[model samples]
Target: MDEIIRAAGALLGQSLRYPVDLGGSSRSTVLRCRTATGGSVIVKAFADDPEARRAYTGETAGLSLGLAGPELLAADIERRLLVMADLGDVPTLADLLLGTDPKAAERGLLEWARGLGRLAACSVQRRAEFAALWQHHGQGLPSWEDEPWQRQNVDAFLDLLTECGLTAPPGLADELTAVGTAGGERYPGFTPGDTCPDNNLITPEGLRLIDFEAAGYQSVFLTAAYCRMPFSSCWCVYQLPADLAQRIEECYQFEVVTQYPDLAEEELWQAGMAQAVVVWTVDTTLRLLRRALPQDGRMHRTRRPVPTRRQVLRHRWTSALQLTGYPAFTSTMRLLLSELAAGWDVPELPGYPAFRAGAGPEAVQTVNSRGPETAGG
Candidate 1:
């Protein structure tokens, strides 16, 4: 700990004090420290390992771009540490959704979508610059763009289906090749990869994203999927009010359409979104299937109203079933539901706590009694 403090203090040329541990995953240690000038800074020291080094590289490159996020104060490659301006004590989107303020949560969700869409639009042309920066910072590691995780997930899930005694659906092809990735050279834009709810801070300045370890550019539909599928890769999963969810999706689409005008076509945009949704659902299932099927677990350790794993996956499969164009993928999701989720003994996923509360902003926009279909992602 002292070594990390010294490294961060050296990089910033200051005496650091009052360090408070901000929770991080196994990959890194995050600290909030007060500078000699009485302001605070965030110091993140990566673990001494290859995966951590790659994460450090991605975050460093993304922050160095200065497109958005906290200002990168300083960095030291040798120590694998970064010092960034602290955004401070702001409520994250997760906080709002978990709290009892539906209006606030709805507003935060829309703002977050708009911010990410605008960021993607503005950074659409920076792929080369990002690649260069990534290369410079990450000499030996692959960027998220070059990672084979997508294809790996596709294969792994097929194996998982076989293990479950379920065969791949025979819709698009016997080989099931159509159920691959939604990515193409078109509509590529920047994303932080893990745009989960907890990582987004809903500050007074607006929505500020954090944790750029998986940062790279990809199809904008992936980002749109997060809004439409509603935090596609997050543990903080629940249903959004139907109207609010549509508004959130529209807010993102409206911003991105400025950069990629073709997305203004409802059919094209919706189709792309459906493809991305299926891709994300497959990736998520591959990762969580073994763990969830054995037994259900809470999505968050301490958060209330959190759904169980089986519930979340069931919700995702249900949403994927509604997607129009992907017959094979839809069939796969249905089989998973009937064969696996049917015996989980869990009810359908419920709406977000804020939106479901009896009082707070309940039904701000009227809709039929049926709320949003549960999200599986």
Candidate 2:
């Protein structure tokens, strides 16, 4: 901590004190520090590792674009340290959803989608610029675009299926190859990377995106999947009322349609979105299946009132079945559902806490009857 603080202080020409450790993952250490001028700044120092260096590159490059996130105050590339303007103690979207107010949660969802879409639409033309910036800040490492992440995920999932005594559906590979093409390529857009519930601040001004550690250009459909799956990679996963979810999806769709009018086409939009969802579903299982198979645990380490791994997987499988045109992927999901999830004896995922039946005064209408919540232990 002292080492990072001294490096940051040197870059800013001032001493930073009273560090409040804002828990960062293995890749970095984040602190809210009091500057000499009585102001505050966020100081993040990356670990001396490739993963951390890459994250530093992405964040510095992303924020440098002035696309979104807090202002970059100072940086020391050699030290992999960043001093950014403090966003202060604002409540995040997670706070709203986990709280008792349904109205605030619903509002935040719609606005969050809209803000993200606008960010994507405006960034469509800056791909080359982003690539150049990435190259500049990156430690000569391959960018997300160069990495075959989806293919790797597919391969990993296939291996996982074999371990679980399951077989891939016959057409799954062909189907994934088909729809998966040109997701980001067709309608590429910039995003803060990890737009998870806890990563964004919902301030009085509006949604302030934080954590560009995963920042880069990718498929707009990937972002869309976040809404459809009700947050694809986040720990705040829970069932949103179908109607509300659709409204949130539409909110994003309308914004992006302004940039890529073709997204307005039902067939193209459906196909791309379905593909992104399929890949993400594979990703979710690949990430959680083995761990979940052993024992159910909270999705987050410290966040309270979070859903369990089994609940999230069950929800992922059930919702994935609603998607069509990926018959093999669909079958794969079914196999996981019957073979693995069945043995777990976990209940189907329930609605967002704010929208659950009989939620307090601010609750909206009941979730459009999705049958008796899957009964289980």
Candidate 3:
């Protein structure tokens, strides 16, 4: 660690002090350092792992596009280190969500949406440039909403349910396959890939995105949907209220249309919603399965300080069911929700009231009848 810090200081041509370790994934180490001249900067160093190397490379490439993120001050690809301007003590959107102020939380959420929108808008206009960088450096980057990717997601979800001793809803696999196939034609734009609220910092200027290790060109709808429903895979899973989620979706759509005037707004929104329901449902289900199944070394570490594992799993399950209320997938989602409610223990969850199977016409109906509750519930 000291050697790396020394290398960073040498790269900056200055002495440094008070290096603070900022926790990152197992594959990376992040540090906040103060230069001898009293300027603050962030330094990220990747492990020797191949995926980590690719992520580091991708981050460098993505930042070069001049989209939304901290300013890159210096980079040492060979050393697997990147120095960027410090974003200061600004809280993340996740922090705001956990705070007492609902209005500030809402503002942070909007800013997060707008920042993503601006990044997508700006990158779409320079797709060629972003594409070239991705081609060269974006290995292990997610292919969001592509046919193969979607199929893998569906199969994985099915496998997970089966492993958990639960029978998947009839034709659920086929329905998911069809959704994936429909999105085969790639949407054009650059995606930050991982847009978890914690990956975004709320600054005086607005929300600034960070962690572009998974950055690449993909469907703008893929990310738009992701913003709408983050699912369980991320620790930053605080979702906006239904009305606010809708408004934010509209805000993102408006920004996209402003940047690409010829694009169809309704089509984009529909596609985004479709992607959201399918992808988030599958991913969140998979997460629940992992929690139920045996432990793996990779799953041992706990990242987020808030929301116990049970809380997150419960949120994913209920939120996915709530998504079924959408008009397009109502029937299919209702069936899945019924099966899940019957086969799984939803009522015993902490803070969640017991739900009787026949209390309502459908599982989602019951969820809606309960009215809005804190995300923790």
Candidate 4:
């Protein structure tokens, strides 16, 4: 610890105070360091692991994109260290969603959507720049055209289900394959990859995204689907009502079109919806399968605290079921849901009831029943 502090201090050209370990994943070590002058900074040190190195490289690229995120103070790639401006102990969007105040979550979601739109817009204009980053980092962006990757995801899901003694629907693999194939060619844009609410911090400057470890170029709809499902395979599981989800989608679209007038709004929207349906369906299925069949070394191995596996699985199942109610891919998802429910122990998530899709304005009315104007104000 002292050696790390000294190295960071040397880079900052100043002495440092005690360093608090901010639990990072297995790939990196994050420290919140206080300077002798009382100011603080975050220093992230990547491990020698290949994935960790790639993440460090991608993070540097993301910070260089001039997006809404923490300011990079300095970086030493050889040493695998990044010193960044501390964004403070602000509550994350995830925290707000878990809090009692529904309005805060609404505001956070809107801000998150807007931020993501801005990111995509910027990346679209600087496609060449991101391409170079991808090459330099040795981490290529995900493409719907990548048949092998698509098939791998599908095969993994099927294998998981089969291992759990659960048989997937007859056409399930085919449906997923089709979606994956179509997704390859549509709405190609920048994706932050991991869009969990915890990655978005509500600083005084508004919502700023952090942790660009999984950041890369991909279909815009991939992220849109992530937002649509709120989050898949994450501890934070907050479901947005159908109407609210629509508004958030609109918010993202508005930002994209506003930034690049030459792009077609309807096309971008449709692509996002298409991509969202496929990704969410696949991700949700995998989550449920994992829950049903817990294997050795299958547990989540992150430093962040999370709910019990059972609770996490229940949240993923319920959220995915709610998404099936959406107008897009309704019949297919409905059939999938029925199949899963038939053999699974679907439990009620505490504090959240099972949400039916297409509930109209009433879906979000209860959360805003106090006053519509203040819901997201």
Candidate 5:
């Protein structure tokens, strides 16, 4: 540890004080540190992997826009070390949303919208250099939505919705995909793909955006969709008044309509719903995979237990059956969920046991002993 600190000090040309690990991707280590003069900074150091190095550098350059952050104190391209200003006293938008007051959430949401609007409106004319960097550097990384596991992953997400007693319309995933793909191809604007509440910091000066790792030029509709999911979830989970969430959505829509007059309100709202499904689906898949594959390392660290295949199947079956009498092609997401349920409800998928109303321990034994099979091919 001492040797690593010494090496970093040599590169930074300052007397480094302490390093506080801020947990993040497996590919990199993030540390919050303070200098001798009591100035705080964040240092992001990448693993030896070249791809991680490229991504780190790309974000640093691409995100160097109108907003202020910790100054880049030092950077060594070869060592993959970056030291930047740390804005203290400011809390993440997540923190603000967690407050008990609805007004607080609304204020935070408005601040976030204003900040993003300023960024979206900034001149891309001078940003050509960073734009080019993004185009070249971000080519091969995975799209969060297009992962191979997605087709088989709906059951896990459906379990949570069922547990919460919320039954969505059927065939939701395909509808969401169609919506996003269409808007992605047609909409005009910039999008930062991962704009969850954690990425925003509400400072006294204004809303300051952080983390440009996944940002890029995208459709205005897509951009709005990207921002809404996490912001909405923050409000929902934190118990912020429902009205505040509506207001936040309104503020966001206002910005979008102001900048892109051609946007249709109905289509934008549909796109937002699609975006929400995408986020929820991915989250649910990981939850299920952890349960079915308990030996997998990622599952061990999470806070919640993975849902058994039987439990998920049961939840999805109940939800899909509820949508049975509804008209065809109603809600896109609902339709997709129904379709997935049809596949998942097959008499037997490799790892899934036969569903019985009263069986618990017996079902676990049956599924685990059955081994892995393509549950829905």
Candidate 6:
């Protein structure tokens, strides 16, 4: 223990106090530590993997907004160790969401978005550099689109539909393929590949975003893909109050409009749905099929699980059908709807009860009685 502390101190150029883990990504260990200099700091030590160095570089540059970038206290690039100021009062948006008051939660979420907007606007000049960083860190690598992560999701949804034995509206896969491909190209602003609620931080000053390992330059619509994961949950989207979902969309749109005036209303609406397909496709595969049938896990789009494919197509259909009625972006939405319907012929798979709370956010949304707006996501 002493030797480890000594090593940390030597690396930090100060005496080491104690270390407290702040759980973060699989690639880095985030810690709360005190330096002999009598100051607190947040330390991020990369795993054995060297890719983390590029991530750190991107995050450092991303923090140029000057609001929440922790001070770079020390770094040992060879060891993949990084130490910075620990912003003490900041709680992640996920933590803040536990608040009892719905209004407060909404406000907090909005604040988080505001901080993100600031980052997006200010970081515009670093666009090329940011893209380069993602490429270096594997953030820009095409998603394991055909990997088991995707197939599993498709399987889970199909299984759920089979269990319910609902006469599913047809053509799900075609719609998703079209939307996914098109949305990837058209989204407006930078897409933070990792926009899970946990990635947002709320400080007394407002919201500050952290964890830029997956931060990269992408079409703005792709950003919505990151944000729309909650809707894919059968539970949260269905169970949560409708007002909450509406507020979320409003806040998200407000931020986008504020950042890019040319952002057309149709574009905003299309981006939201387009991103929705991207997120749902990925999350379902990663979280669902992977869990039920581990051995079959090969990359998503690559290996096809005939059974699981039907289930995922079902969920995708549920989402697309719900969005079909909305007035905006009818043409594009129709395109997705038609594509989604094409998958109805897939044979149903049997396994896993329709997602319940334990199934994750998609299941959670389903329980809420929220509109397809929230549920289909």
Q: By TM-score, who's the top model here?
A: 2
| TM-score of every candidate | 0.92, 0.93, 0.77, 0.76, 0.61, 0.62
What TM-score does prediction 1 earn? 0.92
Can you rank all candidates by TM-score, best first?
2, 1, 3, 4, 6, 5
lDDT of 6 by residue, 1-377 (tens): 35445555787778877876665455676667787777787777666544555555555444432444556566554555666677674545443343334455566656655555555554555656654543443433332222323334444544544553333336544444344433433433454445544455566766655565544554445444333434243222212344554555456656666656655477557655554555464455335433333233211221111133334434444444455433332333344335433434544332222222233221111111111111112
**Candidate 3, residues 168-244: lDDT per residue as tens digits?**
66667666766763332555567666787566778788878888876676666666775566523465454455687
Q: Which of the two candidates, 3 or 4, achieves a greater lDDT against the reference?
A: 3
lDDT of 1 by residue, 131-163 (tens): 998988884888777874655676777788999
Whichever of 1 and 2 has more TM-score, that candidate is: 2
Compared with the true structure, what per-residue lDDT tens digits does model 5 show for residues 1-377? 35445556777777676877665465676667777677767777767665575556555655554343445566666566667777664566554443334455567777777556545545333346555554444434443323323344455455545554546556654543343433443444444444555567777787766555544554444455434333321111212234544565566666666555555467655644454435443443344433433222221132111223433433332423333222322343354345444444323212211122232332111111211111120
Q: How much does candidate 4 score in TM-score? A: 0.76
How high is the CA lDDT of each candidate model? 0.80, 0.81, 0.62, 0.61, 0.47, 0.47
The candidate with the higher TM-score, 3 or 5, is 3
Report how far residue 361 has shifted in candidate 4, in Å: 27
Which residue pairs come into collision in candidate 4?
144-184, 225-276
> Which tens-of-lDDT digit does each residue in 157-236 have in candidate 2?
77888999888879777776665533877788998888887776788888888889878888999998888888888777
Q: C-alpha displacement of 56 in model 1, angstroms?
A: 0.6
Q: Tell me the lDDT of model 1 at 43.
A: 94
**Deviation in Å, model 5, residue 309 alpha carbon:** 14
Span of ten consecutive residues with least summed lDDT in model 5: 363-372
